[model samples]
Target: MSTPSADESVELEWDDIQSGALHERPSPYVGRYVLIRIDDREAGRELVRRLLPAIEAGHPTADPARDAWITVAFTYQGLRALGVPSDSLDSFAPEFRAGMAARAAELGDVGDSDPGNWEQPLGTPAVHIALAALSPDSVRLAKVMERAQQAYGQLPGVEVIWRQDCYQLETGRTSFGFRDGIGQPAVEGTGRNTNPHEAPIKAGEFLLGYPDETGALPPMPSPDVLGRNGTYLVFRKLHTRVAAYRQYLYDQASSRAEERLLAAKTVGRWPSGAPLSLSSDQDDPELGADPDRNNRFSYHDDLDGFKCPAGAHARRANPRGALDHENSVNVRLHRMIRRSTSYGPSLPEGVREDDGADRGIVFVCVGAHLKRQFEFVKTQWLNDGIFIGAPQEADPLVGRSDTPGVFTIPRRPVRRRLRNLPPFVVTRGGEYFFVPGLRALRWLSELDS
Candidate 1:
């Protein structure tokens, strides 16, 4: 595999890029996600024209420290509903044109992932647009929502069909009790470097008009300004069965310590967010808290999967030089930036029983090439076991299986296998959207019908 020459000199124009859900690192304490549909093409365009200024850019200081920030995106149908020209519409990735629901089977969403089970507006063609607002607190978030409502109120054709509010839990844990959002890839030119050893990927890998891992520009939508700096987004509403997850851990392990270790091994990270490759023997809260040390470790040292199981969830999602091929350069090509947030009520801490509450993450994956980065990871890496040398095993945390799933724990003398693993997470809904740059938003607003 050929490694792209490291271009550390590349610098991004934050002002030109939209408030990238991929690399902005908003870390908003509160957020509101609104799904919209366009009833009239003309009115929708006018609405976008009127609201363009309010849409935040990717600039570091775009959002006031105390106030809220807003970002907007549209689905393929949403762009059509707004009367985007046929030529421009045809330029989108085929997967975006196909929509997320049509590819559910390949994504391992056949049973519970079926579009029939998704929320009303999600899987259906009704969803045209998504508006997201992020703020430091609930009050600020409410004000942002109010502004959005006021802006939309003038456009009768734009209708909000669904809204989801999310916040950071006190313990900083997902519903499954694991540290969330710890492992994020550092994009080139973003100025947000997390791990020193991890090479900075090409900007085109996550943004349009820049060189990608292939050293070639990805296929961008027509009208250069409209496509530049824009990226594709995969939005998913995943519901975690916290009670079942907790119970499964209890049943699988012989003791409390073993249970914790089992959970860490399954996820490839301790509850504190320290990677098993770094803190294999115990959970290191200090190391987990230190971003420099936590995300710095790689699988190169533990190739055999003894310290961190080869089939672990994080490992499966991002092998990070752990693959038998030992090709870190190739692995970088498939990397994606995650901008997920927790939704619904947080299950009471230390409570092992099911509270029967709806809670999980609003998973948002942002990338330039949907097929190579997002779809490939979802279909080949996360859901399938062949890539990592585990043919029958799926991801222990999120992989779906009807009969049973297997998780292999590589240990000395004998390898331990967890069998009959049931699905702990379910997809409530999802959609594909195009997050355009600020100029692209303006260009869209001014498109000739």
Candidate 2:
């Protein structure tokens, strides 16, 4: 990968890119995700044509407080079902064509990654399109859903096979009791909030047709108009074992304080979202609340991983400049824009044991290159430990662990090791879809033949 000059400025066509793909639009206090399949080619095309106007496009401003937004994405099969040309279809990344299920092993989902175990509409071949409706409140989201239902109802060939409703918890914590969606990368041109030290990455890194960190434009699908401004999306439904997670903390720690500390070490942050690197001795709720400071620290100050363990979940996910000192890997090349939301009810405070409740996060990853950005992080950074200098460890928070796993925490005198860790998160379902530019949506709708 060639490194692009940092001073180069590239203008982004906001109207062409999908809105939800870039902007940190208002958090959907309530959201509805729907997966559908196309049964009739002509009907599907007609549906796209009619739905094109409702699809939100990227813009300089977004006010979720008063307006709801609906974003549409299509699977490889969905494009074919809509009559996209063969040459254009063949131009997409091979992984997109193979689908998420075919690359399950690379994502660390093998023994339990089979489609048979996935939720309805996901494992089936009929899952061709995904629709997400987000609003600031439940009533607004319902209205959006109603409009979507009415539109889809007009087309008999389009079927809504699966649906998942997600919402922000009152406590602002995921099922695992950790503050969620705190760490997000700043896209070079999105104009979203960014910390002082956080450098804006190239627009091409997250959107097609722009120069990536490598200084080269990523491979886009055929027909410049159809592929430009488009990006690949990875949607996953992860189930968290809240009871088991709490139980493990209790079993490992001698006291409640120790338990909290252990949890923080595992996640690389306190429950309040404070990084251990800044407040290593205790949880600092104030610092965590301050976005400017919470995400501003890097591993360069604490290279030995003493402040924040090298194998910690957050560290493993984004090493920042930790691996850059050796000039081995540039952290910017593998960054991904995260849009994850909690799906189930928060476990009641003081609940120490398993309640048998189904709860987790609906993780959505958006990027221009699925293989280099998303897949690389999943396979190399999250699953393996050699890169971080810990060979026998996995990400303590979300790594696949059928057998006992290990988490090493660097400390003075002797390093602390947490052993016998089980898989706290499981992949219930997932899919890869192409979020087209607004113009591309129209192009897809008009395509014949």
Candidate 3:
């Protein structure tokens, strides 16, 4: 395995890092996810050896003609399945080694969302590898996936345990009716800081072996060659109850216009992705469609939560400048490279009844620290409201609690609190993984050599 030099440690190795680790998923896309389990160490290494070329060695969308990218990741058990040394294996982050199921309590995966109820093969050692291919067209996506299949199709020792195909909804919004991929943070070297309100977060916040927001190198997994350019990954299968969500909003609202306004305030953004900070009273389709101005607003002026509630899912997930007065809360440290793809068909407009069909998103989060970034957002922000000064409130849209929940919307005359907020999203299953860079893939390929 090739090891980067000291100077290279701080440099952004675009070619070495997996594109999916740093870049957002392309919109208007079709994709596939396949989970594998290795019964033989040699077979696992051989699969990696054969699949390396199929995996992109550079930026996901660097080439103008290339519209698809394939990426691979491994659970701790996967590394062990490949015969990675115990010392090196133990060096990974504690949370990762524990796996997602073990940390269910911390992630608020209780009641129906518990790990005991998670989908089969997930949260278990049966999941050794995760491979995915995403492309804007079905033909291109299938072509890439075909190459991946050839890598492990004939390997008797490698078993395909599960697979899911995802696509962009016609509405281009999440199942809950809000723009899905708005307001992603920019990484320092990646040139993602297009929004004037956002500064590129330090690279180390997302990639290993680089100086982070704290101006220090993030702690890398042991064995420099294996850890450098790698990042922790979290993928959860969240099942959204679209019908219930709509019914609740319909029940709370007296009219269709009020219903739309209620939904926008809940997500801090309009159905078209327009942020409430810019258009508080109404949905601005033009502003929501503009990439330049949609995500340009801030919470500094709306600290009182009149425009956008402090407890809105988006606001709580990313406070931006809203928490500046606290001084102790640094939003950058908790930021991660998050992307998701929708599975199942979008619930048709004006329908509020259960279709009895499974539909939701497969959320993929990439970052250097699982505990601080992904888990922190899940527990401290999404599942708890202490950070936003609403201790009793969780994220109104996605928050999961046993008792009846309350969502506060600060407004003129009187503050409105929506009570009995149900868990609109349920955890189907998930796992923690380490997505290694191109060089690290080579390292895994030769593990049995």
**Among these predicted structures, which one has the highest lDDT?**
3
Error (Å) of candidate 2 at residue 101 is: 0.7
lDDT of 3 at 285: 93
* lDDT tens digits, residue span 191-281, model 1: 6555556677888898898889898999999888878889999999998888787888899989999989998998999988999988899
lDDT of 3 by residue, 1-449 (tens): 12212222245888898876765677788899899999999999999999998987665454423578788999999999999999899999999999999998889888778988888988898999999778887999989898999999989899999999999888888887778878787777764454445767778888888898888988888899899999998999999999999999999999999999998888989898889999999989999999878877679898999999999888988998898988988988998777799999889998999999899999998899898999989999998988888888889867765557899998879999999988888899999999998898999888853
Candidate 3 residue spans exceeding 4 A from truth = 1-10, 62-66, 192-196
State the lDDT at 211 in candidate 2.
94
Worst ten in a row by lDDT for model 3: 1-10
**TM-score comparison, 1 vs 2, better candidate:** 2
Clashing pairs in 2: 2-214
TM-scores vs. true structure, each candidate: 0.94, 0.95, 0.96
CA shift at 15, candidate 2, in angstroms?
2.1
Task: Note the Cα lDDT for every prediction shown.
Answer: 0.82, 0.82, 0.86
Full candidate order by lDDT, most accurate first:
3, 2, 1
RMSD of each: 2.6, 2.8, 4.4
Specify the poorest-scoring 10-residue window by lDDT in model 2.
1-10
Pairs of residues at least 3 apart in sequence or in different chains that clash in candidate 3: none
